[model samples]
Target: MIWLVSMYLSSMLFLVLGSVLNLGLSLLCLEKGLSWFIEWEIMSLNSSSIVMTLILDWMSFMFLGFVMFISSMVLFYSGSYMSGDMNVNRFMYLVLAFVLSMAFLIISPNMISILLGWDGLGLVSYVLVIYYQNEKSANAGMLTALSNRIGDVAILLAIAVFSGSGGWNFLFYVDNMPKSDSSWLVCFLIVLAAMTKSAQIPFSAWLPAAMAAPTPVSALVHSSTLVTAGVYLLIRFSPALESSNSRLMLLLLSSLTMFMAGLGANFEYDLKKIIALSTLSQLGVMMSILCLGYSQLAFFHLLAHALFKALLFMCAGSVIHSVKDYQDIRMMGGLVYHMPLTSMCMNLANLALCGTPFLAGFYSKDMILEVAFMSPINLVIFILYALATGLTVCYTMRLVYYTLSGSFNLGNLYSISDESSIMTSPMIFLSVGAIAGGASLSWLIFPCPYMICMSFMFKTLALSVSVIGGAIGYVLNMSAVSYELNSIKLYNETVFSGSMWFMPYLSTRGVSEKFLMLGELYQKVGDNGWSEYYGGQGLYFVLTKSSGYLQVLQDNSMKLYMLSFLLWVIVIFFSMI
Candidate 1:
């Protein structure tokens, strides 16, 4: 308890201090960087002035503010919620690890610090994700760790490519580092990173599994702090995104991730799990906007989302506490009568999430749709995004209707009043923020005037769509219109058998040893496609599942055999030499 208290207090101080320092330093840096950027463009790459300016403009105060806000909120919420749990101290330590890591992530001037923070976060989150240490939680943590490591390799390559020629830093807006020759490789690697972190497509399986952690952990991880790490990467490398060869595929991936995940959230019955899936979808939407060159909107939505979604998850936790362990909304009907305060908070949050006008969701999401329309991608993508907006409304309405409105039907389960002030207060605070979050509020370093106008226009569009969509959704939930889009279920059926198409040759070793030699060796082979006889999927799958059988000799004889083989290979090399 002492360690936990000390950690929380230290973290709180860090957050308070960091927010102040970031505001002053980052804003000053951005202005300096911007001025230098203009001069660099005029003076050309040969001038030494480029290096001077590179130091100033490489980061943003607004982004730092985000990092601080998210880290602080996660810490505060975790401290309060996990107080009585057995592993409270351990959880607090992990929370500190994340805060330290995430702080490093935003301020990281070059790729090295970025990679360090990224790796640290991946490691710590793995521990936190499996905090319960049960079979299912362990499996989820392993999967998250595996996916994170896979993405980490791509970042490592990006660092290598940048160091080789791009002067080890982005001195200008368009510092074409990997050069046009390696554009494909760079794009491919970045896309891989985004896929893993943002929970896009095939890599998305790990996110749903992450819900095995505590609710507060889930609130922090799923809402913004970790899941949106990919978006942070995208924003950081916005300059590089333009250089990718597979622009169309990357764009499609983003849009598809957004629309498809929205559908999945609808099908999910568990309140928190639904929010988790929705988090994945919203991130995809943000990426799609970023890919379309809409930075302001993306940043705004990231903030708006943090406000509402985190609140929703926290409120869900409250409901669970009140009921003593029910997650599925099907098991929780008509709670509005029982827990009126909780119900009101959820309703407000759901309204915002559904993108209704005058709400935070409307403002950020509208801009995404607006910017996406300007891109030359398929019109079908826009239609898909629009339909997702509808689905977002429908599903959120379902949540609101089932959990809060209509009846107080826990099906004869004894009703309980709003129990704890600790839990309900956060929801109330967040609800207030959700209602007024985008209402002409000025951020310290961000252009308040520009943001306010942009937010208004975006909110108008979002509100219009959400209300219309919500009406239709309400009809469907009430059996007024019975249509299940089933888009979420589509990917499962299609990717079922064909998923084994991408198997990668791991090393020069025989089929047996090829499966060993750690993670790096495997990533290398994945990058270089060996479409030959042995490296193909069918045979590799058979070899890997049976890898346990190959351990054979536990004696020193095995070591002697390896030593002899090495000596023989060396002698052959000398003879050749």
Candidate 2:
């Protein structure tokens, strides 16, 4: 127990120190518009040498600082959350390994070195996801691991393609790739990899299912490190992608992911799953804006989203811990009266998520809308972006209504209260970040003016959506007819959205069932019939019959011995003649 406690304390201290160092480095890089790279040769090939490289720039340094900061807070929170578990030390080590993987990924600019970090993240995350050792955790871990493996395979393929460049350092030649169809194919593959990592569209099923992980893992992985890796990759490669033809496809798919996740969040009842879907929705937002060539805005939003989303998850964790693991929001209400600090934190995080004016989300999210309006995008993307933004507010408001308001529905409320200081301290710390991170990051990332020419209606469009969505969310939740109408008329749609548009089924059962049936058929026909008869059973019978004839010959009496000797003598006589 003392060892575990010391490990947690030391890990927290190391992260805090790292965060401070990186913050200073980030500020210096931003001031001078400078980047530093250090490389050490690992192997010398005939033409190209393999090397380990680290990159220090404003982007990497700032992101690293944020990751370390969040991770430190999460470690502190975990001390309380996992205190009773026998395997708390194991959990702490896994989280530290996770943070180390993220740090390696952030600092490495070379593809070869990046894969080290990339695969490490996938492996550690799978372990963390199944930490509970339950059937649900196992299944969710498999889905998460398999879903991310697609991205891992995509990265390996990309590395193979990039090998033709005579070096594994993508930062050097990514901008110089020939503008041909083959080059665009590479870009597409990179985007595909990014999509899987970021949970865009078809690859999105895993993000919500990963809620099976503990809330601290969710706060770290979903909010800042793992999911944002893809967006960060795209940001770094934005120069190359600008010339590729795949941006159109990326635009459409990312917009759809944003819309789908937002819609899904509204229908979700599980507290943690709801926040997970929100992370998915925000990831889509980052990806879509990155596709639109506003990577700086996307980066800004990514950092800001990380702050609030982590806070959101931690607040949700506090609520879950207090209620004895009840995660369904339908079972939670009047939490404001029982757990005021937690309720306050939850409300603040939800508001930040909704892009309420002056909050962290407002700074980046509003700018994204303005930029999207000003860009030369099609009407479809524009409408989807607008509707998705509205849906974000809608779901956040719905979450607030269900979890914080109304009557206390839990059968036992006596034991429910604000969590201990260890948990609430992290919540409070991140709550301040959720409130201020956007404005700070926005100013740092864009010191110059971000001028825009837009009409009054266009300027107010985002706020208008937020207000309308909030009103609808509240009215629907309060209405007596809503449940009856949902059951009678909109049952299918409700089920669809509630099930994340059936994406979990599609990715898991839909794919697994087909492969399983094929295996069964092969077992019955090939293994049991053809293979058994022709290979195993037939060979055994032939060998057995020959052995029996040999035995009969060997067991022969004097007559058989004389016959064999006579046959040998006849052969010798024929040869001599």
Candidate 3:
């Protein structure tokens, strides 16, 4: 117990120290407009160098600082959340490994080095997801791992493509690389990889499924470490993507992802899954804006979202811990009366998610929507941005109505309270960030605010949508014993929207159903039927029968030996004659 406690304390301390150091370095780099590359040559083959490289810049340093800060808080939170588990030490180690993986990804610009971190994040996250060791966790872990493997394969392909350029360092190549088919292909692969990591559109099922993980791991994975890795990677690759047509596709897909996630969250009842879907929605906002060539805006949103999302998850964890492991928001009501502090933090986080004025989300999310409005985009993209933004608030309001308002529905014997100081401390710390992170990041990332000349109608459109969405969300969720079952009335639409447009089904069963059936047929016909006669089992039977005949011959060896001798003698006499 002491050892575990010490491990947690040390990790939190180390991460906090790293966070402070990186923040200072980021400020220094930003002030001087400086970047440094430290490269060590691993080998050289045919004029192409295989080198391990670390990149230090304002962007990398600031992102690293955020990652470390969140990691520290998560570690501190975990010390209480998993305090009773026998495998707390293992969990701590996995979380540390996860943080280390993100660190590697944040600092490396080389494809090879990035893959090391990228793959590490995927592998470590799988372990963390399955930390609970249940059927759901196992399935979720598998889905998460396989979905991310798509990105790993893409990075490998990019590396193979980059080999033609005589170097694997993408930092030096993203610009000034002559426009060519190879360059286009590399950009496409990079986008594909980023999509898989960020859980955009078709690749998005795993993010919600991964809520099967422990809440602390969810806080880490959903916030700064895993999900944002793709967005961060894209922010780095935005320069190259600018010239490629893939950015347009990314914009459309991310917009759809945002809309789908927000719609799904409205229908979701699971508290953790609701939050996970919101994370997905926020990720879409980042990706879409990045694709629109506002990488700084995307980066700013990423940092602000990280702070609140982590706080949100911690608050969710505290609530779950008190609620006897019940996660359905329908079962939670008037939680503010039972756990005031957690309820406050959750409300703060949700408000941030909704882009409430002056909050962290407002600083970045509102700006992204405005910038998107000003950009020359199709009507479809514009409507998507608008509806998705509204849906974000709608679901957030719905969640609050279900979990924080109304009457408590649990049995009288159940007692729920926020007594865990360790858990609430992190929540309190991140609440500060959730309130100020956006404005602070806005100032740091943009030396001067973005100036956009737009009509008044366009300026208020985002706010109008948000207000309408929130009102409808709260009013719709107000339930009574006499009320009609609207969800039942619109069953198909409910299922379609609630299931993320059946993306989880498509990603898992729809994709593998035919292949699984094929394998079953092969097992019956090949392994059990025809192959039994010609394959390994058949060979085994034939060898057994041959051995039996040899045994019979040996048993009758004396009589058989005499007959053979007589035949040999007769043959010898005929040859002599």
Candidate 4:
């Protein structure tokens, strides 16, 4: 216990020191930019004293704050979550590495540092996710690593494009972006890279799937700053957003994704899936806000969301742990009386997440909408995103209802109350932030009454939408109308009357939906091309055929490998000249 406590303290201290150092580094970036080496990742280039390096600025500070705040809170949360686990020390090591890598990634002035940090976070998170080593968890971690690598490839390509243009350092390119068509291409690739890391559309299938990991891992990644990498990238290069259509595309996709994810969360049965989807939705809102030219608002939203979400996630772990790990709301009911304190904490976090007035989430989320409303969006898109927010409230209330507000069916364990201070300390701290964060952002608030009233009016409008929508959903939920469609509905309702599992993926018009929804169509027209050719059958046959052929040619293949090895050695020997 003493060792665990010491570990937690040291980790927190490390995060704090790292954050402070990042600020000085940020100043260096703002001042020197392309010249700053910024703690090299691997190799070094020759440098001159006269070049302006170290160009750290507000953006860097904001990103550093995000990485440290989440990592520190994650440390606190993990202490409680991993209390009795045997491999706690190893877990702590990976978490620390993840934190260190993310910190370095943000403050990195060049591609080398960024890639190193990027890969480091990926590797560490993979280990953390599969910390249990269960078959299910291991597969999920692989997916996370695989998806993250795909994102990294896009980033590397963008770096290649940037480096080709004589901008090897990230700070130089971001602070002084080359206003060219090639830069636009680089920005596009960068956006692709960001979306993959952020789990934005087209590549967002991995997040909900990653719930197989330990809950603390979810709290760290989903609720923390890791998923906000895309937003940070866009904010860090606000100049790039101003220069290309890539920014507009990003905003459009983010809005669409938020609507889908929020609605999808409303339909999900698992507790973790809902939070995961909400994480995606919130990132969408943040990205959209940032794209519309409000970096500070996005930053504040990112901070506020991380705090409240982390608190709620730990509360979730408590609920699951106390009740023997029930994730589906259908199985959990009336937990409020047993775990009163945890319930209250979840309630506060949920309300704040719904952007209720006077909460931290409200201030940041509201500002995003305010900024968004000023920009042009179709009525359909507006109502959809607005409705998505409403759905966010409904599902959250549903979570509260099923988990805490319903009738208790299970036999009692030790009477559930507040968790230990070790657990609740971080949660309480975050809950305080959730409650107080609205007042913290100065740009959005003022001391005047009429203005306050106007703000109330706007909130009232949003609140009205949320309440009414939730009320309708609640009625539908209980009316027996939704009951028929609730069970195994995604595959059936998605397409083919229960054949495909496209629940969260919204259907589009024309050939795209038809091809996706109507696989039978392809079966009729191109059975070999669509089904057997691409669906593991062809690969299996090819592998079988290759194995037999290789068995017959094994002696010859060995000789070829030997010959090739000798030729390579000879080439190297010659090149030595």
Highest lDDT, which number?
Answer: 3
Cα deviation of 180, candidate 2, in Å: 5.2
Q: Is candidate 1 or candidate 4 better by lDDT?
A: 4
lDDT per residue as tens, model 1, 111-227? 554676788889888988898879988977877787677789988897666554544354332356445676566667777887788877657767777888888778777666788
Candidates sorted on lDDT, descending: 3, 2, 4, 1
Clashes of each: 3, 0, 0, 16
TM-score of 1: 0.75
lDDT of 3 by residue, 1-577 (tens): 8887888889999999999999999999999999999999999899988999999999999999999999999999999999989989888989999999999999999999898899999999899888888999999899999899989999999999999888888988888653656888998999999999999989999999999889999999989999999998888888899888899899899999998999999888999999999999999999988988889889999999999999999999998898889999888888889889999999999999889999999999989999899888899999999999889889888888888887778778878888888899899999999998888888888888557888999999999999999998888788522468868888999999999999999888998577679999999998998988899888999999999989988896887889889999999999999
Evaluate model 3: give its lDDT. 0.91
- At residue 301, candidate 1 shows an lDDT of 85
Taking all chains together, each candidate's TM-score versus the true structure is: 0.75, 0.90, 0.90, 0.77
lDDT of 3 at 431: 96
Q: Model 3: residues >4 Å from true position, as ranges?
A: 479-483, 516-577
Candidate 1 regions exceeding 4 Å error are: 1-10, 20-59, 170-174, 411-415, 440-465, 480-577
State residue 68's C-alpha deviation in candidate 2, in Å. 0.4
